[model samples]
Target: MRHQKHIIAVFGGREADQKLLEEAEHFGQLAAEAGWIIICGGKGGIMEAVCRGVDAKGGISVGLLPEAKDIEANEYVGIPLATGLGYARNEVLALACHAACAFGGKYGTLSEIAHALNNQKPVAAVESWKIQGVHECNHAWEAFEWIQTQLK
Candidate 1:
């Protein structure tokens, strides 16, 4: 039997700072190198950064957009899924992936984390939230490592 590629959802702020964006980009690159597909919110900031990294490494990126318009997705998104569910799309994002990772974010990111946990998906956080049951890491690489273990 052929093994399926793992899908990892990366959640973060749409208006994240440059440092956070860089970290997210590196996280996406590492995930791609590990042969995992990246899923994200499909907008700007961390989403765009991660998608760009995935594109740079020739990895596929799936974008879950809250809007119905395909133009809402970032340029690097290889696959744009327009849900038109707004914040409710978080449920789809959580359920669609094998695991999830959260960078520094706002309410939207928090919602994604909650949805993932509620769906029984393992989640790793990098300088993000401090909720119980969520693996916390100091860096994106650490978070990816934890996610890799969880996928096993």
Candidate 2:
């Protein structure tokens, strides 16, 4: 059987500000409504917000966990894939999608963005402070629009 293509993966810090969370939710909802499967870290912060939005919209959300035995996925995740690779799995998550959106984040998010670009996956930033090699956007819809183009 042919598998459907998953579009964008959303990457951000495990802890984010409320404003970033709000933006992430909007991005997630729009992507989900477009039939895109949302992929995230399966933890807190922007990841939780996005997953919550996807779930509320009745959309598909896949969480690629950092650890198998000790990690806890966010409440909104629809599918959880536990990887014992820890931070190494971040690359796996970023690589699985055609594109990625990075919200406000820290070094981990920065690493994911770098990996995505290096792997040739286009990345869009929604409120993320300057991560090298990604197309930055102040608006969530703008990021989503860019991701849609990459998916096509």
Candidate 3:
């Protein structure tokens, strides 16, 4: 029997700063080193950063795109899944992953977090929202660790 690869959803703002982008990239790298695949919004900012880190580590990265156009996905995305659901694609991204991690984000990121939680999926946040059910972490490593625990 073969073990299933864990798919972790990474969520954040498209307009993230350098600091947040670096953190998201580090988080992706850590998760990839642990033999996990990454899923993200598939555009720019946090998504692009995470995908870049995953690609650097030779790990697969899937992007759930909001638009039907495949070109909308960032250059780092290994697989672009165009949902054509606009912002509603967040629900699909959350539902398709084993767990989720959130970085600093705005309304869209918060919605993804909520959707993940609503689906009973475990979520860890780093420099993100302070929701009651979400596990707060100081860094990506901590957030990834919490996600691992939830997956088990």
Candidate 4:
């Protein structure tokens, strides 16, 4: 049988500081090196940074767009899904991932985390929310390490 590829949902705010962006990118590269697939909201900030990092590693990254326009996705997104589901698309993002990671974010990120947790998917958060069931990490590498173990 062929090996199954793990899909990682990367969630975060549309707006971010330089530090968060760097962390997200670093995590993306790590994930890419592990031969995992990255999925994100397909906008700017953290999403773009993660995609950019994965792109640099020659990995596949997908963008789930809130709008119907594929052009709305960040330039680094290799495959853009024009879902037009707005916030409702978070459900798809949550359900599709084998594991998930979050950088600093707002309610949207929280919502995605909730959906993933409810579905019994492991979530590793990097400087993100301190939810009851989440594996909290201080840095991107920590988050990557935690999720990698969860998948095993």
Alpha-carbon RMSD, each predicted model: 0.9, 1.8, 1.0, 0.7
Candidate 4 residues lying further than 4 Å off, grouped into runs, are none
Best by TM-score: 4
Compare candidates 1 and 2 on TM-score and give the better one. 1
Q: Distance from true position, residue 106, model 3, in Å?
A: 0.5
Candidate 3: Cα lDDT at 96: 92
Q: What is the lDDT of residue 35 in candidate 1?
A: 90
Instruction: Output the better candidate (2/3) by TM-score.
Output: 3
Assess every candidate by TM-score: 0.96, 0.93, 0.96, 0.98
**TM-score computed on alpha carbons, candidate 3:** 0.96
> Taking the tens digit of each residue's C-alpha lDDT, what string does model 3 give over 23-84?
99999899889999999999999999999999889889999999988898999999999888
Q: Model 4: which residue pairs collide?
A: none
lDDT of 1 by residue, 11-107 (tens): 9888888888888999989988899999998999889999998998989999999998878799999899998889998889899999999999989
Kindly indicate the candidate among 2 and 4 with the higher TM-score.
4
lDDT of each: 0.91, 0.87, 0.92, 0.94
lDDT of 4 by residue, 17-77 (tens): 9999999999989989999999999999999999999999999999999999898789999
RMSD of candidate 3 to the true fold?
Answer: 1.0
